[model samples]
Target: MSNAIDRRDFLKLAGLGGVVFASGLPGFALAAGQDEFYFVQLSDCHWGFEGPPNPDAKGTLKKAITTVNALERQPDFIIFTGDLTHTTDDPAERRRRLSEFTQIASDLKVKTVRFMPGEHDSALDNSAAYREFFGATTYTFDHKGVHFIVVDNVSDAGASMGGEQLEWLAADLRQQKTDSPIVVFAHRPLFALYPQWDWATRDGARAIDLLLPYKNLTVFYGHIHQEHHHMTGHIAHHAAKSLIFPLPVAGSVPKRAPLAWDASEPYKGLGFRGVSVDTQSGQTALSEFTVVKKAQANATDKT
Candidate 1:
């Protein structure tokens, strides 16, 4: 399948109680008869965020959790890419937000939920508080027939994955066959999407070079606060949308500020994503869900 997101798929939304699958991804061939498993990705929730960009910031995260719980088919697990909470200069407040975010996330019905840090959660203090709440910054695990790698670029504060982590990644990849299906979870874009806005990881190109040999590699990341798809050779990079609020496209304006709230289009560009992997055919389906439907948006507009 082509890497380009189909126009129809990009425009599709998860209406009140619906999920719309996007075009399938090619080259992930698993053995015949293997069952399909999917996971939900909720990124950039920014739990403590409160501002004009999202008037209902406090309620959005809970709504997303409710939506995921209400899915007809629950995911095997759920992963939050990054920015779990808004930045706070006070270390005490930071821990409080992290604790609160964890408490709320614990309500997720899935068996396993994984998390990584965004700059907002880590940069101020090298992820000390985040690590106190979450675990290792970089790690790897295997699910069924696929290998998953979680990279930490935000911890460095310089937006680089760092040499030690790079070595760890290289050693880890050495154990897997070049053709093994691999999925990487990260906070920032590995490639230079827009360096001016800090969208690109400083030393991410090196990590990308290390991952270049993998045949069925895909990356899911969040930081830009929008849904974006890109390619680095054979690897596909997908950026998830934010649950807190949406930001303008890369370089769309002179600044990287969050887009203002539109009373008429409440929750317009805010939601989570569902990624389904078909082991038999190696096809992956992406589904986008809005936090609120038309009626809900309208109702919230009145509030």
Candidate 2:
């Protein structure tokens, strides 16, 4: 199968090569005989954040939890892509933010929640604090006939998944069946999204090479703080929006930063994404929805 995204768009978003990679719609739908599982993808909460990026970052996270709790059909599990806390080396600060994040989960309606590290969460000390609070740098699990791989793509300085993680990725995929539907979760996009601003993964090409043989694969990530999709062969790579704030589109500006919202509608641009996986048909479908915070009650009332 050819890559899903066009060469021009890839160059524009990735700011690297203008050469066409490949082209074809990779199958994400379930195969003929398998059970279906659905899940939610949330990213970049920055639990310790306290700024105009969005007033009351804590409240916005609470709103996210409430929204997930109220989903009409609950997901099989939840995956938080990364950046659970703001930039900080202080263990106390990290602990506090993690505690707050965990509190939000106390009322969660979903049974499982998986987490990965973002540059911000790991920048200070190889994610020492985050790992202490969470667990594991990278791991894999199988559910209902599908393979789920979570990778530690961020380095101590906020770089992409480096040599060590890539090696582990190759070994991990070697054990899975080629035909099995694979779902990879990470903090940064694996494909070249924009190397200029550190949006693209450093050694992502090697990671993609390992997955090229798989007939069915999908990658879900957060860190770009927006919703975007690119396809490479049979693999579809998606970046989820941040729970705290949104960023400008790739290359839209000289540099990327979270866009500030008007106080009246703080949660205006915040939302979560839903991914439905059907093992039976071997298909994965995505949809996004914004959550209304308590402070946005009037806005919701108006709508």
TM-score of each: 0.88, 0.83
User: What digit string (tens of lDDT, one per residue) describes model 2 on residues 22-47?
Assistant: 21212122222325556788898888
lDDT of each: 0.81, 0.73
State the TM-score for model 2.
0.83
Candidate 1 steric clashes? 1
- Model 1 has an lDDT value of 0.81
lDDT string, candidate 1, 1-303, tens digits: 333333233323322112234533222112233365678899999989887878898988988797788776677779999999999999999999999999999999996999999999999999999999998888887777878899999988789888889999999999988877788999999999999999999999999999999876789999999889888887778899999888899888998898888888888888888886643323456777787656766773322
Q: How many Å off is the CA of 189 in candidate 1?
A: 0.3
User: Model 2, residue 283: what's the lDDT?
Assistant: 55
lDDT at 215 for candidate 1?
Answer: 72
lDDT of 2 at 55: 59
The number of the candidate with the highest TM-score is: 1
